[model samples]
Target: MLPTRYVRHSPPKETTTSSVNEPKISVQVLVLGDIGRSPRMQYHAMSIAKHGGRVDFIGYQESTLNPGLVENSLITIVPLQPPPSLLRSNTLPFIFAGPLKVLWQIWSLYYTLGYQTKPARWLLVQNPPSIPTLFIALIICFFRNTHLIIDWHNYGWTILAGTKGPTHPFVMLSKHYEAILGSFAPTASFTVTNAMAKQLRSRPYNVRSPILTLHDRPAAIFQPISNSEARRAFLARIPETSGFAAAIMAGETKLLVSSTSWTPDEDFSLLLTALCHYAESTDKLPPILAIITGKGPQKQMYLDRIASLTSTSKLQNITVATAWLTAQDYATLLACADLGVCLHKSSSGVDLPMKVVDMFGAGLPVVGYAAYESWEELVKEGINGRGFTKSEELAAVFEELFADREGKQLARLRKGAVEEGSRRWDEEWDSVAGRLFGLCD
Candidate 1:
């Protein structure tokens, strides 16, 4: 299931926030849970504080740490933890986890809203409306006479169901909640594509304000690097390419794929399996390294399965590598690779992998599985990289990223990512922050 969230409730008839002379209106915006060490949350919190207002964010304990740092901006990091698992293992019925999660959500909403002595003037929430927290947040706003902003990072149920395949009733109910809450609260939101924004508009109660999806990064990252220093950079960042020696190698080319995990979804398996097929067909099986960073529900199971596949196939070419690194280092590693690959479990049409944006931003030619139309659209086929939604399509992109036309064209296509970042995404955070804090208004 998707993580907990703070939802918006009924709109207020009137608000007292009109006076411009009001000394930086104290805005207490509470998220659904604690900030789980998410840099995204940190970035948002900092953005609010930058505007000289008080910002508070609540999220799960794993991602959101308490006692967070807030400077001049209106941001605070609130923390929370999931209730202990009632079942001994993850094999329990979805009905159980689903209800348990909702209970926690209810608790969070009550704690944040029912207890607020002074109602916050504005509330910011993610898109899923089923979250009691989001609904409770809206109640706080109504009582306090504030405004709301809903953030749609991705489709939670869509991403999770991609891996599990076929949803349980609980999952369907979760989606129903998402639809209801999303429709109920009107606010500015994030959309990966214009098509998605259109779908949101079709919703019965989607509040429309502004839709800003992922944008480009700093131009410096994508700037050209001379061939002379290319090898130096890749070799220097050896940690990223740790599986180089042990992974499968076909002919002269080495195949590599990478992905990160979210709560219920880990979407790269089909692509990885497809890459495995590619290795099987070729005469020379160069090292095929599958590197995964970060953690999620299926991480351990994935590692064991890949190792089993390698042992059974009697090919020493495939190896699994994992570690944690700073964002810059992660992007640097992508820059050093012979190719970049992203996988999405088919169900995950809702989420636009932030890493995909990062990959293109890093000047890496990305090979992504087309789970969302957003990624498919970004790839433009044969330009940035390729998307493989099915078992048959993976090897073709693998051939491109490793050999065929892909090898020779890598430099130019990779360079495109850098320009996209600088012009499209990275620097805009300041503008976004400014607007969120009411500086531009």
Candidate 2:
């Protein structure tokens, strides 16, 4: 059972720090998410596993399980299901089943707890603390002599609400939980994008605490290819690519769009309008292929918004790719695209994203509109990508990036950045295996 809600996710003001001398502990990994289908951290964790250590997976069965995972790693998967009600679509009578879904994750976690063994050296808890399975793992780790590790993928506690830096009761409220979790988990570390890491280290949370972990995944390679040959292959697989791209070519200029899977709060409607205006005035419409990879709760809302926007503005090229694609193909397309988009609402809980890193890894740049410190940090002003908070600022930035020789130059620089990002990954977690596990020096 969850501990009594004494602090209500709030922590004391007294700050804490870790000694420079690293503490020793036995390490084993316990993961959440539909292990097979979870593309983001699952792969990163597996990458760490390849570095040499034991990786045990506790996840549900998914329809599109990666064949590679089953073939490659010695991962142990635990099958658990959310109540069937969670997966089934809700009806109008119910209004919203948001709370019900959250309950379902927690319910599954309860079962995950029963399957666990006592104590390992390291316990990586990917969160929102949404699922009961994770909490159970935390408790089990606590009992079995394992220290809990927080990946701050959720940063749920630090959520702010808008384009500006911080705001109102939300900020104050978020601060309380951030501190509480800071003290509560000794082995905590944040896997934040550059912007978040920079902010947490300098402003809110200090670095030495070992609580702020930078999630330094390699960036995608963004290279421009006028591929006549590969284009055919891409078109064949992408079905409707010819008509979609062609129609959109005359269809919309500078199409402002967003991913469908992202929550509605991080909506890019205002930004889309700005992009539309930029195109109208400049005669350079930036067509958008808004590929909403993976279905999430907000998919329908996004589709509706996209449909509405396209119909009114009658923007030509703004299209959506809702179909599932293999991970490699997914990476390839994102890397090949003109630009990638992301938005982090102030109300965003733990706004860490694998896409931001993957964007950079694929050598593609990202344009992020962030409220809290997350993907926003990755856009180094004139460097890897653009980070915007205001809708007004977006079109101008996008135009600047797409215009002349400068845009191509920027793309190259962004691609070059992937090297440094890869180095960061190797540097940060290179010794993670040795440290977490009793591996060789």
Candidate 3:
């Protein structure tokens, strides 16, 4: 099991002579995607700002800045021009021009950083467009005398390999290129899980830098909600779910919530198939209000599939509703749910899903599809949640949890889920911020 205690580090004690000479710390965060979609980056920026460091954020202008971030005086938002049509549309030109576009953005970043009056203390960058951006950022930091911090979610090369096969020339080239660049000295390196940290340590590159594990934690925004409040908020957010809302109000339905990006990594069909099996095997099942949230490339395809299933009367007792939700609405929906379903299978088999963490924060028990070996640390079977590897097994789990008319099993799991959520990362990001800023003495 993963340790429950948060990682803590004591900063070096300072003498009176050195105390007067401490320079003001500043950080510049560079990302190639939408800032709003990048929650980890947001957390890093907020952590730095909260610890008295000024932050300059550079990213594309596709999404609005978070409302809280907009009002913060310690942070400045510098929007980059949106990528060209070919890159935005996911077309053939993207494969060739994507690196060039990232290079161009880094060039733009150089000018933005050059215009600053004070030299930044740290340059924090997210990887995946890893090699080219890292190569350029390292050279820039070398000349500017700034420390570099690379946060690894997964390799961009591995994502490409998933589509083009592991032996593809591009994949082979990326692996070699990343190794050469990643070996250079950096202030610190971070990954999302202990398993991923192990993978980074075992790489062929001779990186002497500390590789830290920083799992995703929910912000204070998500909290448990009363059943009545959750049902009302869910209905307000998704009016099309009136039938389900009615059932909820009548005390005749159980709410099942699942959040997805609708991407290839998550297998939504598995959940659908399990639902079908559960519906067919049980006769007097309670009405279920299943809400699936988020928008992505495969959304339309899944919507069509759901429509087809409903039209054919495959799932009779279950009412499935899919909608895109705002952050507040999403949290409220989760807070009200009796059970949360997670279908994420990591693309690199390393990164854990932030969605599940959000669910835990709301004290909702989960039925998750097991994709990684490290999942047992968080989703303890029959404790807070259950994990299944097959459709039949998942269906059985659903039956075991909800099929009890007395709600005894679900009440037990719910209590455990609340306890787990309460203990989910007891330490705040302020400690991480203190370590990054050399604040501890």
lDDT of 1 by residue, 26-68 (tens): 4444445345434444555554554454555666555413233
Superposed on all Cα atoms, the candidates' RMSDs to the truth, in angstroms, are 6.0, 8.3, 6.8
| lDDT of each residue in 1-441, candidate 2, tens digit only | 433321122221211222212223323344455665555445545544554444455566665655545654444455667457544566523324544655676666654543443234566666544234344655665555456666655544433334224655545655655645544554656555545444545535554455455555552232333464563466446753544554333333222223434555566475556556554654554555555566667667756876786778654544555656666676666644556677655454335555566666666666777555444445565566666778777767766765643357555656654643554454455454234434424
The lDDT leader among the candidates is 3
Candidate whose TM-score is highest: 3
List per-prediction Cα lDDT, in the order shown.
Answer: 0.55, 0.52, 0.73
Please identify which of the two predictions, 1 or 3, would achieve the higher TM-score against the true structure.
Answer: 3
Clashes of each: 56, 36, 0
Better of 2 and 3 by TM-score: 3
Task: Itemize residue pairs with steric clashes in candidate 3.
Answer: none
Q: 2 or 3: which has the higher lDDT?
A: 3
Global fold similarity of model 1 (TM-score): 0.77
Rank ordering of all candidates by lDDT, starting from the highest: 3, 1, 2
Q: Give all TM-scores, in the order shown.
A: 0.77, 0.71, 0.87
